[model samples]
Target chain A: MHELPILRSIVGVALRHAVEAGASRVLAVDVKVGELRGLDAAWIQSYFDFVTEGTPAAGASLRLKESKALFRCRSCGATFPPGPHAGGDVACPHCSSKHVELASGNELLIESIDVV
Target chain B: MAEIRTIDIKEAVLSENAGLADRLRRRLMESGTFLLDVMSSPGAGKTTLLLETIHRLRERGIRTAVIEGDIESTVDAEKMAAAGVKAVQLRTGGACHLDAAMIEAALHELAPGDYDMIAIENVGNLVCPAEFDTGAHRRTMLLSVPEGHDKALKYPLMFTVVDCLVVSKTDYLPGSDFDLAALRAEARRLNPTLTVFEVSARTGDGMQGWCDWVADGIRGVADARDGALDC
Candidate 1:
């Protein structure tokens, strides 16, 4: 997972934001990560705690919101949400076509950080 | 009592790495250099295939250099040096992937004027290497037949991000239960524009196609810079 580096950046960004806001401590970080991004939210929280130790972001919890991806069927020209059984092996449900394209949901963005 | 507030920052997770990569890419464009970032799992024949490509290109008057990334050894760099190319070794001491910062450091050590293309052989881990942008104009990956076709399905991110996927070790096609068609289909399903070549670096099978594809990337970079100057 790239979470170690990404979470470390998150901590840095959170602390910077907290300082800019004149807050004494950071409480939580809200992030929007894609469903297919392959990051473990629980692991990110644990790592964030460990990495942020001595910083303003110490003890801050990571609040993750999984953003689901959209798939477009290249065969039938249809767009749909990637269902539960979605992956390389998955086909378009509407047309049963294997030629599907990932339209969105590879994003990993920091929405906001709560600070006090 | 302290004032609590929520700061809206909406920045990308890998922005730090991507920012460095952008600088490197700009430098490469200005210098008319094409960098190929190659990634694969350990023992996917990345070294062998890359060495062979270096050899072939050298005979045709094209100078190529390498930046080899490993956990902690000079073995691969030694091999590249013996092959008579300018080489730089980046020993991460234990990191699984090579980030743009590492590339920036290595590029400083490497003589940019000495080569037309710099092919970076990233630390051999499919998962983590794909996540970091190493400032390459083109990104490619190798998946050996021995690794099995299910790899693309399992490691979808790797398959999704790569520009090309070389199905290596085609010489062992008879021994392994590798389904070529299914693997190609699966990879295509993930990334429609991914160019694939079934290659056997040991036997020199399918090397020409790989070379041509790489030449295209090099030429594209060269032509783009020239076109910009013309405009």
Candidate 2:
């Protein structure tokens, strides 16, 4: 549902960079998305294609790199993937402490753009 | 022909909106107004809960305003205005969530200086709204009894981002199989610092604590501003 708006921003970023770099056209937009974001990469690509029409990024391919959600244990200072904690209890793998902080996973960024 | 080249932009997709949201937060704080963003799935009793909260805040003499975000219709905003509090309705058309620019426009109409606090009822969604920052001082979400305990697992991002969680519609808890403990545990796992409140706007169960929390937030902002002025 929100893919359009999200793609709009992504295309905006890619185009801005391409124009700033004096590129005539954008070839591809690389995005780093966290698993926790739950965004469908295919949906984003379809919307990107629609919104970027008639723009410098019209034919750009959207390449998404997904990152896993990791939790950092406050007690042990160890970061581990959330996959290991599928038991409903997200305890630290190193120290088994319940006191853990989400270190990363909510990322949504335009990593780079291939242009000419 | 120009050769293909890769440019490392390394920019967050929502950076522009985030920058605007941060600036809005600063501007609201400087005006001594605290903004709270309330989010939840539809029919989670956000409006009812907020109506009760508004009544309680009024009793405490805390001037408050509301910004209602909906995909369509002004029904919620009208209800808020009927309660005698200043209200603004943002129609997002087909957008799933409200972003900083929308909130900033609403605040312009609100003249937030007159209010101690402003509460924004975000569009009913468990996903998209969590992705956008609305420049609110705090973010809270409601999960009704019927929504089930599995929501934390199903929508972990929403549970992770919110500062507070209100388990609304507790009046139905008696006949339902809603496992409050499991929900709490799961939510806490996602967000250890999350504040949980079990409330039923209809029966008024646990409204005091929630209302008091809101009132305290309002006063805290006012007090902080006063302290800043004194310094």
Candidate 3:
């Protein structure tokens, strides 16, 4: 339900390119969503089917690849993933610095599209 | 039969929104307006905080206007009027968040140059509100004591995206189990650049500091404009 707007964006991007390419139909759309984005592939696919009806991306499949979050320690310059911490309870393994910074993994992007 | 083809387009799914937000920012900055998008869950004292901030800013002779975004009803806008401020309500009708387009419309309605500072009170939602950008210079997220400290952990995206984390309802801290240090620690770890503030609308405990921040933002923009004109 929360993915509708994002799904619309995905469909818009795919169809725009597919139409520019003069493609009759879109086969699939591959997206890279970060874990923090909180969008599931299956749910978006089900939503994609309804939102893409009668468009170039009609019946197109939705593919999603999730990215993991990366964190960098601010005090020690150590980089690590969040380990069993809510609000970062653990310290950096390299230097025991608790001051960690999020490096990545909050991406919600479309990587490619399959058109036919 | 048309031959099958593969297209390589690695575009951000929300590029359109991002682009519009950038353009809006440029527009606001050029017009000498400072915009802040305020967000939080329902009952997190957003309106209460806004009322206090606006009243205090007015007392200091700072011109401020508001854009109230809600699912429905103009109750919040009415409250703004009670504070003797100008506010244009953007009723989402049911949308959980206010996007750039909605803000664009509201800005025009408010008209530029009338108010140097503008605050957009986004729909009371912790999730979807963080996803959309309302073309503000900074995004503020409010976390009340009743909301719990673990919110920074349960809702990482919202907490991570905000520029300032305002802990509202601090007047109730004595009765609640909220830990300011632990919560700020996690929030800072998520985004080291984030600024934290503790405030209570009912008691006006930290409103002065929050108001100062707002005033500083407006003054910074105004000073730059003055410098540009001088040259």
The candidate maximizing TM-score is 2
Off by over 4 Å in 3: A72-78, A84-101, B1-3, B227-231
Higher-TM-score candidate of 1 and 2: 2
Q: How far is candidate 1 from the true structure (C-alpha RMSD, Å)?
A: 2.9
Report the lDDT tens digits of candidate 2 across residue range B1-231.
Answer: 889999998899888889999999888888999999999999999999999998987888888899999999999999988888788999999899999999999987988899989999999999999989999888999999998878988898898889899999999999788998888878877776788999999999999999988877777777878888899
Across residues B150-202, which tens digit of lDDT does each residue of candidate 1 receive? Answer: 88777877887899999999999996789888887777766767889989999
The candidate maximizing lDDT is 2
lDDT of 3 by residue, A24-115 (tens): 88998988888887666678788899899988788877888888888887888877886654553556779887676777778888888888
Query: Which model is ahead, 1 or 3, in terms of DockQ?
Result: 3
RMSD of each: 2.9, 2.0, 2.5
The positional error of residue B188 in candidate 1, measured at the CA in angstroms, is 1.9
DockQ (model 2, Cα): 0.60
lDDT of 3 at A4: 87
Candidate 2 lDDT by residue in tens digits, A9-39: 8998888888899999999999999888888
After superposition, candidate 2 runs with Cα above 4 Å error: A83-90
User: lDDT for each of the candidates?
Assistant: 0.85, 0.88, 0.85
Model 3 chain B: which ten-residue window has the lowest total lDDT? Answer: B184-193
Evaluated at residue B21, the lDDT of candidate 3 is 92
The local lDDT score (0 to 100) that residue B9 gets in candidate 1 is 95
Q: Which pairs clash in the backbone of model 1?
A: none
